[model samples]
Target chain A: MTAVLTTTAMPPAATAPTALRRALPLLAAPVAFFVAFFAVPMVVVLSSSLAAGGAPSLANYARVLLDQYHWDVLAVTFRIAALTTLAVTLLGYPLAYYLVRVVSSNALRRSCVILLLLPLFTSNIVRSFGWMILLGRNGLVNDTLVGIGLLERPVRFLGTEMGIVIGLVYILLPFIVLAVGNALATVDPTLEEASADLGASPFTTFWTVTFPLCLPGLIAGVIMVFTLAASAYVTPALLSGGKITVFPMLIFQQYSTVFDVHYGGALSITLLVFTLVLVALAGRIGNGGGDRS
Target chain B: MIARVVLRIVAWAVMAYLILPLVVIVGASLTATSYLAFPPQGLTLAWYGRMLADTSYVAAFGTSTALALAATAGAVLLALPAALAIARHDFPGKRTLLSLLMSPLVLPHVVLGAALLQYCAALGLMRSFAALLVGHVVIVTPFVLRSVLPQLTPEQRALEEASADLGAGPFETFLLVVLPQIRGGLTSGAIFAFISSWINVELSIFNTTAELTTIPVKLFNYVQYTIDPVIAAVSSITIAVAAVTIVLLDLTVGLHVLSNRR
Candidate 1:
């Protein structure tokens, strides 16, 4: 398949000099675009964060580090993100596995894929607004809980961590399913079959053979979910009912209301560094898992 | 058999979880009640009518549509050339450059928004449409790059070479041969970029004024203080737009991404 595809209409292999020359012009547009907009804006933020009172200072970082409010918000953000990631992986992996390994009908699988993607394509406000209605006092969720005798009164879901978690999980689940499903689809069934033929139980065959192959996808999906959930602003803001505060909310307030660019830049940099560190750590784990496989 | 039944049940439940919020928003928007309600109190389209009557909502919608369209166009222009370079050539810092372009996908929009606000303020561009456009373009360009790059295979490169060898200039070859092959990727990428820009609140929130706002940002502001059918109406419109876009996407590019992999 690879060889046939490669030969179909392959581009002439240009000489080194010509390839470099042709590529240089093409690179100019995107390179200049990113440098002007992305890289420059980020540099601006970092510089502002580092400079205070006309000199570089640790005051901004010190403010972020020394403040209990910042720590509390960061903790809440990380806790919600971790929980969301765990829930998505726990729920997504089974659905992905069932779709890939169990489902026989192509039509059904296709429909399932569409259903998974629908939420992803929808606006965050629209999705969170739906939850707002459902989690409201007269919302279906509260009504259902009451109807089922689970609660005597409608619990306040709009202003709680649980509400944010539900919203985050809804938005992030599709990433996990798609990632895991792609991995599951590519696993060599022969490997699992051989394990079974060697007198291993079905469960044992899955654990010993199938799961290892899909670990990289699982890790990638988890990392994506965690990073996104941690950085999420709209969902948390909309669902939190002004009672819950997260890191992004602080950044928004600084920029939008306070106009404290120096402080805001520091907060933004803090979140960026934290998210990047976690992403790097997750990549390391994914790479380690891939090596073992 | 038990395991199969359990798996089916779980899959169905997950699907319901995905659809529930959208259904609720649409239902609430049609409610005759002034306040938002679920099983909606006496179905009516008054909220939608009210939404139309509000000029701010209308203006916000117009601004969002224009912004998203402009951003998506800019992204396509920037990304197409970049994808060609990355796919067809090797260069120093190529991997780093690609990562820098794509990092916006995972970078917190609040941070980007704050950065842009600070940067633009220094340049006397803050809180203007231009400021919003530049930031939106920065974030959405990566989506276009990602979708277009994978479609530019060596095979496609060969076709472009063939076009060039047939006395076609680079621009002519790109238009006649290269563009048609990657049309699917471009269209899908543009759709994704457009929607991402349209639904954006974190990035748009910084630069948006009371007079200049996107729908999502407007909704976010209103949603904090009030829960009403008008908000529901606005949310419902966005939901409908999303449904339409997804259907169009499904028709054009086939949204079923994972089913045929095996």
Candidate 2:
């Protein structure tokens, strides 16, 4: 996930009294730039979401919250996101474990990491386009399934939730792998060794020792994946093929085609608030587990 | 041992899944057919040639490259100072300020794009190069800051002090000692920043005019209506660029990020 970009290392404990004055000048430009470009735009969106006819009102929110159609869209959006998260974690944890614990050759591990990042570095459009080709009625996926007699006919994946899930999982798998792989790498083998020496079976050792230690990273990765999957615009847009819609698609439609800033603002804020709330809850749960362990 | 076997199989299968789409795009690009084909009816680079002949594709590529370059430079300039300050000094709202700077990483780009469009329109900056550049810089600056902050360790601070004690000025100490120590991080962060800006679509889509669109956005509009070899060729170009960048990064900075030694 791009959150990898913001993951902090240790900050210095404290600084000299004079260091604050020296640092103030350095902080000024970036802070001012962010306030101007980043913070203010978000404020604009928030204000628009609340404004109706020049006064702050919840009319737009009522429109969004009252409509059954919007509810259906939100359901579909979160369904795909939850399913994507589940699938990616299932598929990603094993890969991360293999890369971190099983692969002994450093060169091979490096190669695997590169392969993991290649798709990530590519645009979402290109990646979803690849699926657009493969998940077509006559695409490779259906061809292989039919060839092997698993299906009597070509299955339609395009415009289906399954197609969207496949693409989202593909797009997001690397984030979980990186997050879990880093966590797995940091687990001391001696702890597991001690577990085995204490007569715990392999399964028990993994469940009680290894997995808990890496739970924080796993939770972080899940949050990143779920937030991204829920709010994703490009993948769902390209893969949904117009027969399906997600929440971000609704926001995009309002902003791009309808140019309904007020309504669009409400929709955007709705998605943002829900995502942040879910993330905060997840963070709390994760922290609680970490503290317990 | 049996469990290990199953894990290996699943892991390898997932790896193949990860590589399959990229291979398909590259393979489809080389097809001689007018339409896309997998094992490519026949091998030909004609689509790539056609893409090159189209000046719009060329222009979009040029615009995307220039935008990414400018954004990378801007992020480095803005983030390096911020990283130094956050690492070297404690001020009021330091944690609040740090989160504010990094908030773009988690915020939805679609919302950000829409917000920028609305906000920039108020300021008369919408749908221009500057608007696109600012949005790109905002999103990518966190990459530089994240990578650079860790390099400003207490050990490095000790080195900086030593340089100052040797009668070096602040600029001289930064240039001679601090800069050399953080060079690896700076390069890695800059590369990440460049790539993020280059491959961005959602944010750039709002601020891009027909004439000033990025490659991803161009391919996006074209792909929604059509699936041709030319689009594949264009996508293949971006994938190739990604591969080259990764190889370059691995060779230069050693992208062994999963190491336990940290």
Candidate 3:
């Protein structure tokens, strides 16, 4: 399939590079605009990060990297992201399976999909606001817990890492469901039946066959969730109630409040590098999963 | 059988988790009390009325709508041409160019937003609508490109070539042969672009002021210090917009994202 796509997708691979001029008009506007706004601004940030007092220096990096506070913020940021990824995967996979393989009613599936997309389509602010209301000391979750005698009194959640994790998980769950559901929908069920015919139990079939087939999509969704969760500012900020701070908040404070672009630039570049490295690593993992499948 | 039953319960619980928050916001919006309340202490639409009465909320809504619309239009206009070039033609450094165009997807908005705040400040464009629109276009254009590039398959390229060979002009070939086939991609891409722009807070936060804020930014600011029924009403409005958009997308393009089509 890959070979066929590569061949047919490219007509006459040896075709002349002279055809480039024909694309000039089409590429001119988009390329120019990206260069001006996107490329130049990013370059400015990179250069500014390397400069202090009108001379290129590593002082900014020393300030950002040499500090224990920045490191602590990064650790907290990644810990929340990791936890959110785990929770979303644990919760999203079963729902995706049910939606794709179990439910036979088209109307029900459609409604499920719309409901799933409701939070996705809504703004993160609004979604986090919902959580803010629910996870408050007197909010629904607390009220239910206390009412059910599960807790002596309302435990504080709004200013804790637990609150942020729940909010981040909610914000990111849809991506996993969409990713895994689409993958599950394409898995040939006959293969599972064939595995059963070969004297495999349901658990064995799922572990040896069914699971590997969708591993690539699962990895993609996980990468997306982790990256988004790691970079997320709004959900963490809202749910943290100004008590807990993450990496992005540091960057925002530097820029929006501190007005220190040099330090802010270093923070921004740090995030960009970390995010890009993770994506690259995950791409390799996803490709390996594809080969195994 | 036990596993199946457990899976059903878990799936239903997950769906409930997803719906609970939005329902709480909507229900709270209707409370007759000044404070937000779910199961709404005496149902009323007065909060929504209050939102309308507050000119700032009204202005923020208008700004958000107009900004989203303009950004979506800009993204489509920019990305359609770029996708055409990348998919329809083979050029030097095509892969690098494509990656550059799509890098915003991975780049954090806070980073990009800060970068723009600094860059625009140097160019005297800080806190301006132009600055916001440019950042939005950079981010959302990738959506348009990703959707449209797949539609411009080799077979579709062949059709374009065939039309040109059959004495059709370039504009005619694009308008007559290309546009109709990619309309679905365009619609889905545009909707995604518009919603992304509308919901954006990180990028807009740097550029928006009290008077120039988008709806999401306004609500974000309001929610931090205060949680009122009017805030619930405003949030409920965004949820409504999301629902309407999703329904429209389902009706028009068939949101078969999880279907077995691929």
Candidate 4:
């Protein structure tokens, strides 16, 4: 979560003078650990991405950017991610609100939380594999649709954008629910009550007061969903049935199948940069809303 | 009344959406069909038996368990010291250092996997258990650090100081005073770290070979080529493991992550 990233980004304050010296030794291990493992690998990736067949050139980037297939893949990736974010927010916010405000039973709320987190703990492969079964022809989804006379034929759910979206929404919905639920729980009920007391209707109270307060959580969830959905490889790979492609699929293909680290590095760097940019923008929006609130 | 009804309907529908895949997987694993069938022609545990019978599945499970355990332990050891440093210290570029350590959470794992693969190949450690373990540790450390750092409050520091003043050595203070206070965080973090490593496919996929694969990666490879009850059985076992872990976490730390509690 961004909690780890944001916590790490805190500007060092020279408030505790004597303790600073005491903490120096403690810092050595983590700093060294990161430098050796995290930073060096990243540097290797960057260097590899830039170096193309023993010469530094933008040819890899040129190939990535100029390729029509890469564009289509990137388009598919972002389209699915954006749609998944929208769907999860729409579905998750209400559920979060319901859990926060409507569900009064402590046991029920706890159960819902557990249900939400169960998929998160499961492997993406397992989750997507579940969808692969359900979304296939003669799967439960098709059987139910046919039984209900909703379809003349079994709708192809596997290896489609819709299939990928469904899997992603399932995978990422918990983030939105948790984020919005936390924000909703912290909202002052009195403010909504006051709005009602001032002749506002319940809907108006929710829209004018409650919704604004939970916006940060909603935004946070959206950003997390966006970034994760964008980068997700396993779900799309499984659900896509090898017929559909996303940006991560390209990176995976390059590294795994082609064994082309240089081209794979370029693709990986592209996705990483784009994802980071989107996340940064989302953070800015969330922080801006936080300040306004 | 209409509004309330609509909200209830939407909430229930969303809940169904969330639970649908999991239900199907568990159900399919119980099917008598050689191939996966959702409404599961007839209930049977033969698939589970088949999964258990496979040596590769068993080996992958063993490897995943060992890797997750080792990675979680390494993350805790590394993160505990790091958390103390970040929470209690004031150092130049500390923020950057922290971000570098924690950036793996947001950075694409496929990218990290590729990078680590490339990096390890240079050092002659590619496709080995060591290469995989180090990658897993890097990704999982942030979980422990994030969870543990928040627990090291000024109040906790005051308690640590008190322990030190009471003739407790540094190690004794950490063991008796600091650790107990952060035990919940450490436990939750370690659980999360372990689960993250267990569920990992991206990083592990890069380092895992046919002979040395994790369960998830193995399933990933198999599911691509075949869709059978055995794969369902493997997937179901993982789902069951995940369910057990969640229940354990719920019982231990309480999974009311979004409850209206301070």
- How does model 3 score by TM-score? 0.96
TM-score, model 1 to reference = 0.94
Q: List all candidate RMSDs to the true structure.
A: 3.8, 4.2, 3.7, 4.1
- What are the runs in model 3 whose C-alpha is more than 4 Å off? A1-16, A285-293
Model 4 root-mean-square deviation: 4.1
Model 4, A1-293: lDDT tens digits are: 23222222334454555445556566667677778877899888888889897999888899899999888888889999999999999899889999999999999998888888888899999989888878888888888899999998999999899999999999999889999999999998888889999999999889879988988878878987898899999999989887899998888889878988888889999999988888898789778877775
Off by over 4 Å in 2: A1-20
Residue pairs clashing, model 3 = none
**Candidate 3 structure quality by residue, lDDT tens digits, A259-278:** 99998999999988887787
Give candidate 3's error at residue A284 in angstroms: 3.6
List the pairs of residues colliding in candidate 2: none
- DockQ of the two-chain complex in candidate 3: 0.58
Output the chain A TM-score of model 3. 0.92
DockQ score of candidate 4? Answer: 0.57
TM-score of each: 0.94, 0.96, 0.96, 0.94
Specify the highest-lDDT model's number. 2
Off by over 4 Å in 1: A1-20, A188-199
TM-score of chain A of each: 0.91, 0.92, 0.92, 0.91
